[model samples]
Target: MPRSFDEILDQAAVPDTVTDADLDALKQEIVRDVTATLMFGARPAPEGRYPTTLDRAEAALTALCAELIHSTDAAEHLARIADLPIDADGALHFGCLLNLAQEPDGALWWWQFAAGAGNATAAYCLYLYHLFHGELRDADHWAHEALSLDTDIHLTSPAPCRRRKLDSPPEVLREAIERLKVDEVAGAQFHHPDHRLADQIEELADAC
Candidate 1:
């Protein structure tokens, strides 16, 4: 029992819905949620960057039209996020999430797509991925690519994750990424009235 009135207040009075064990559960949930945001949501890469949600359904549709050049068992995930409206920044972070899921092949596919869109941070990720896998030549190439793209700073970045934390990261990050897509669509609609995003997405699908 809380010995002090202040402690009870801080604990929210422990209503019927709040069981004795709920406090600890809530605390653990907070940690997991924060970790999910850091690992999958927008934060900063070592080089620097930052991070959204909705229109995930639409983004997934866009992704479906695209083809995966790599990825062992992540075609489903890839098909859920492609081209990533903001110059493939979504791709960059999704790659990190895929890495957390132990899908390096999937990560490479996304990183390459992002890199193709001139995402410098994705290039850096490619460099790191290749280096870790002992593919020095590819790593060197990606290092150069990252260096060349240094001036094109991005607002989103990737982070490292843990095995135990994987459970909540995907479900939580899915919502985050979906909301981001919604925001991206809103911004695009607001800024570029003439260029319908749906049409563009359709064209992208055709191009693919």
Candidate 2:
């Protein structure tokens, strides 16, 4: 049988010879690896780029939680994980908390918190959520914010999840509509009466 999260933590052994700095570094590396592997299927370089197994991914997360629980410098650890000053990786970590919740409301709270802290991935997820819910204006705004950080970026849930239809990078869809001629791109789809130049903001949620 697979070990439970607590069991995995109980099994983790740190040598007396390992310095705190090294332990901290190890914790950071593990968090980064699990996040990239689970979320985007990307591997941190100098390592092979392959998806992490479910058991190993869970173990990494459980170990990181254990590290936080036992960390002597709690403030520094908190600062590192909270995506302070807009670190995209840190934001993604917080977003993982949503998957652990019983309902999306709780997850949205955390995602919003992370997005407010300038986590672009969180904002992008919010954009998708709003789009799925048919809230065009809100979706358009968050999508813009998300694209500002990385045009080529594509986000996916780390695991099988609901409301996961946003597969293309927002910039891709935006560029497609940009190629339309002046006469063809008119009307509510191209121009919102409330905000000019907001082309395809309304139609995209329905079409996609």
Candidate 3:
């Protein structure tokens, strides 16, 4: 039997012992996993067949990256992902890197591109951007857009299961900024009843 989603997530969260070789191996694994899943979905592309399994696999890898990659090699991870093709909504991978890089402008650009292509992660990133920058109207738009596209609500909740440590201060700082935006939007929105209980989220954003 296949491992459950929670099991896969737990496995992905295991911190790799920091080594250049370890980083390289993990990077290769990520790229391979991402590419394999994308190609699997593309197998019936000309006929427009929706490969739900492949899509879920892709999302799982993305969430894994979001949960795992941290300060020690965050820049390297970002650089690697930035080199990948942004053909699909997978550009969220690149935007996540930009967020890690603390390049809000760059992150916003990629996020918008992915959002236009219907990536909920990208939409959520863009929403957070506007929220932190105090662009309320645009923030609301992107927040709603994110919600509209994110039918599964994968990253919306600030669960402890989603928390991970960064190996560097800069990376942690950047992550904090991004988290702040997430909470800001979450707080202002009345649609989510759970938003009120997101105290840590509010605190994290406030610190930024």
Candidate 4:
């Protein structure tokens, strides 16, 4: 039988003994594979077509980087990540920045970059960021953008799991920001609750 998604990810995950060179090589490989998947849609392999397994493997590698990356290497690592194409809206690049980089501001910049490139998850995170900082107007706009991407989104889960709103607003926002809490970006995903707050907030902004 074919290996399961979790199995593949476990097998492909970066080892704790991974060296700088090994990590660099793995990142390059992930960039290539993800780029090809984005470009070609689906490439035929002897085993099968592209699936969630590949995506999970990529995330596992990125999460591992969050664990093994050194503070001194963060700048160089970010520079390499920035070079990856944004066709996937720099998902992998942003993930590494958000989950590994020690500088919160720098990670936020990468989130803005990804959101600008139309990454819904990044946009939602930006929404939460702005909301937490009391920039409700900007948060409203980002929330709208996120919903526009996934109309029936449920903004609760820490990852792309089933639809539910178990997390409270504070918890949701906290989890989003806490993604940078070192070695923990494996399954981070975001969604937005159904609401017309964005339009109302925009109108309020206009009047101000």
* Leading candidate by TM-score: 3
Best by lDDT: 3
How does model 4 fare in lDDT?
Answer: 0.45
The C-alpha local distance difference test score for the whole of candidate 3 amounts to 0.48
TM-score for predicted model 3 compared with the true structure: 0.39
Task: Give per-residue CA lDDT, model 2, range 165-191, as digits (tens).
Answer: 233424533443344322222221221
What lDDT is reached at residue 96 by model 1?
Answer: 54
What is candidate 4's lDDT per residue for 116-143, written digit by digit as tens?
A: 7766766666665554343445766877
Of 1 and 2, the candidate ahead on lDDT is 1
lDDT-wise, the better of 1 and 4 is 1
Sort by lDDT, top down from the best = 3, 1, 4, 2
In order of appearance, the predictions have TM-scores of 0.36, 0.32, 0.39, 0.33
Which parts of model 1 are misplaced by more than 4 Å?
1-87, 151-208
lDDT of 1 at 78: 36
Per-residue lDDT of candidate 1, residues 1-208 (tens digit) = 5379887686886567777699998897566445534443632222233211112211221232122212232333333344333446556655655454344555577678789888887786776666444344686688789889886543222322211222333443333333332223322211111122222332322322
lDDT of each: 0.46, 0.44, 0.48, 0.45
- Each model's backbone clash number: 8, 0, 2, 1
Deviation (Å) of 117 in candidate 2? 2.9
Q: Candidate 4: where is the Cα deviation over 4 Å?
A: 1-83, 87-96, 99-102, 152-208
